[model samples]
Target: MSAPENTPQTSLVHSAYRAPDGFEAFPVGIHHASTVVFPDVATMRSRDWREKLGYTYGLHGTPTSFVLEARLAEIEGGNYCRVTPSGLAAIVMINFALLKSGDDVLLPDNVYGPSKDLSRWLQRDFNINARFYDPMIGAGIAELITPDTRLIWTEAPGSVSMEVPDIPAICAAAHARGVRVAIDNTWAAGLAFKAFDHGVDIVMQALTKYQSGGSDVLMGAVIVRDKALNEQLELAHARLGFGVGMDDVYLVLRSLSSMRLRFDAHDAAAREVAQWLKARPEIASVLHPAFEDCPGHAFWKRDFTGAGGLFSVIFQPHFDERQTDRFVDSLRLFKIGYSWGGAHSLCVPYRMAGMRDGWQRQGQLVRFNIGLESPQDLIRDIEAALMAMQAD
Candidate 1:
């Protein structure tokens, strides 16, 4: 199927562009580039505005880097894409491009913690006003919009709590108000869902996770639908002088070749793990988009093909945070760490009380990122951890 994704590197993308398209992608390879030599001055000018197939400086782009950008856009089903040094940079670039001083932006309460921090930075520095609405606000997001509301951010199955939003409905509502919608599609990784298919205008992804696969590279991408809007974002990006290492781009490209295979494995394994976790008597809930208990499971079922390696398991109501901490500390397999979508298993407890206001929840949440390890072994890890927690 799909030629086993083994097509030669020389093959033209979509069989177009008769230019040099060589170099088989590899996992450990990195193309270090800071300056690009142009064939002529004619090509140099083309890099002036992301205008043509030429590179002016390393910060602008290089052939190696362009290849990865093109492949990411292709896989994500977006017409335009921009790269940033980190996932948060992508978010910052989007804000810098779309928002002006005194303009307002809305974010999901359960969004990534650093995102809130970034928005606050914008608010404090640029006179921008930022507010957080509940992730489950969905179509109700319309009520929060105002004449100054310029950007509306959405995250399907919002971070930590895993509250999937009604993206189509939110997009429609924002479109009606002439506001743009940007989604944190990092969790979906473009394999499980297509943002544009749901009427999203901008799709932001933290490619550091699934795209890099190795957990070594930190890169991000912002895919925009409208070329004109994309140009504006590009200007801000150029001003910020954000540049990704060509080597990191190559790593992500190499990961793309195996994306489908790896994604399917992750999905199947994650589903099994989530199901088992839900069945455990010690677990009060499994906060996974695929689970019916998730806030917007219906939307997840309709829009997403699969889930990644991340999910959260809530301890029984009677369990205290101390007990949960012991379980996490006693885990032999799942290492306690931050971030997800890596090959190694990880577990971390999050206090909802600190993350949000009036957040209602009992028991500590031990977020899990199941690795590529066998499902049975992961299950045993969980079993043993729970056993140790009980023993203590």
Candidate 2:
């Protein structure tokens, strides 16, 4: 049946479907969309999604995602940014974008565990070669770079072991050989250290940690200052069909505003706790980048403005795995878990003997992710746990 003249249908379709355009707000509007409607076929055909001139689909870009991307890029001093589902996914995207069969990639021996695993997979399935290098090698890394090397991966204050590398020196070596350098900048959160200023070509971070202070969101970002490199990443990112939920993007955006404050607070608290642990009788060594004894403390002192709340302590030589577990189980405030940058403290025990070459530590390793808790109270918790273990 034909609609009556001057019907309400036209008003509803026009007004409800299209809200007024000039509305302003403190927060960006949550633009949830899968398919975007074009004004006409001509506009749709003329739009180039690659240039970010306009959005083509939900996977490509949305206003909310774009806002988050822009803010993150600004913070990291990069020109372009791409958000991924998880940090590891960002790593894989970089690998896929930059590497192919027979190409070689260099990784720090103390690299993130899953990244090492992914490199192994790439070697097996794609015929790419993966080589592990010493985190402290710095410019000496040039000697290890073969003619086939395309990328060199660096991790500051190496994962779990807590050893900072000379990033500028490494970047110099990598760039001198025409090899791209990608750093896992999660620990620094782009605030402590300037990746771009140090000559790094790409900076990848796990936004799930500091960026989403609540630990309720899992997201990652790949940022690049170079337009050509950004274009390469953009093509691979779009082809991989990596789409993040709008709600998570909004959560990260909210957390990002207070990230600097939280990071400084965490840094201060962790240093206090690490120093307290250093004075303890049970700790064999404290692997914190701020301390003189840490593997690359000199480089850290030279490069970073601050450190994160993550650090590890090696127990006295006599402590066994079972004994260490007992100590960890005795803690009340610090829970045993994986991942960090949450409000609650976390602890994880590691057997470091087999993780890398030239295993030097003689005791159990315990990593702590200090949260927004009183340093004294955290120290008491550690004391109580040590007493409990000693009593047992």
Candidate 3:
């Protein structure tokens, strides 16, 4: 349901609107459609099920989802893209399409929390062999690929720790082995990291986060390069009944119009906060890909164009898990929450042990989802929390 990269300006081919007739001025309108009427029984019958030539049911495809997919494909520089109910659904579609019971999949140890959980489930339930490799594996991934391996899942700057991996190296290794490469590009949101440009065959993202521009809608999308793999995913998607709500699709489209602008704000504000926290005595280090202490700052600088609003800050030597909780609890501007990419700032504490590989990084991990707030105010809030932590 995505727009072609080489689409001519003649008209919006997939768009329900006739551009010659003059579409509405603002590009932010939400196209709400559940059931689209066909011209005739012949046309409906002739519709291609293998591809999204046309639609049959609401759950299958809608005008809003179709338009969103087109725009997403344009953004990701991919040939095809599809919308799903959530980010995990998009991952599941890719997995179910590419791998079978005996097939093997390589996943980076530094993946999204839910994605890691899903991989474990896929191993136990589907009997698909999935293994986790370190995010720093890079070109060394060539050593892990086997004939049975079908897919490789990677996430740049693993969620909590923000470790930007050598995406190109990883993709080259997987692609050389004739394996598919998919990434949770939700962190970069196609803004910081261009997946298709890096040889990624498939790009998966949580549109619910940055794309929605709000915390309301839950949506995800998967971008594919080849038609065959895209068709396979489409079949799995149809069988699984994975489709986004029409209203949610509308909301996502509404947010997408200003996606670049919102991402700009997020990047600026987050950099400010990260820089501020780095200078603070209560903060041990800033775990942002753009920062020096981050796991792969060199890779981030080399491969990525920019950073996002989400990052983590390690507390100073004096702070422990208890003080970290106290600081989070004492915050006024920041809410203790899991997800990011909303209008509100969020803070979540994670145990260093839960995401460790025998590394001796000393600090309680506090993930920050910076909102569209004034940097000065967020700085003030952090100062207050630090004061509270100091008093405690």
Which candidate wins on lDDT?
2
Quality of model 2 by C-alpha lDDT: 0.92
* Minimal lDDT window, size 10, model 1: 10-19
> In candidate 2, what are the lDDT values of residues 65-167, reduced to their tens digit?
9999999999989999999999999999999999999999999999999999999999999999999998989889989999999999999878799989999
* Candidate 2 local lDDT, residue 242: 85
lDDT (10s digit) by residue, model 3, range 356-390: 65647787889999999998999899899989987
Q: Between prediction 2 and prediction 3, which has the larger TM-score? A: 2
- Against the unseen true structure, what C-alpha lDDT does each candidate score? 0.85, 0.92, 0.86
Q: Give the per-residue lDDT digits (tens) of candidate 1, residues 200-267.
A: 99999999888887778899999876889889988998999999877678778877877777777877
Any runs in candidate 2 off by more than 4 Å, and if so which?
A: 1-17
Clashes (backbone N, CA, C under 3 Å), per candidate, total 2, 2, 3
Candidate 1 overall Cα lDDT vs. reference? 0.85
Q: Mark the regions of model 3 whose C-alpha exceeds 4 Å error after superposition.
A: 1-36, 357-359
Query: TM-scores, in order shown?
Result: 0.91, 0.96, 0.91
Estimate the TM-score for candidate 1: 0.91
Looking at model 1, residue 177 earns an lDDT score of 99
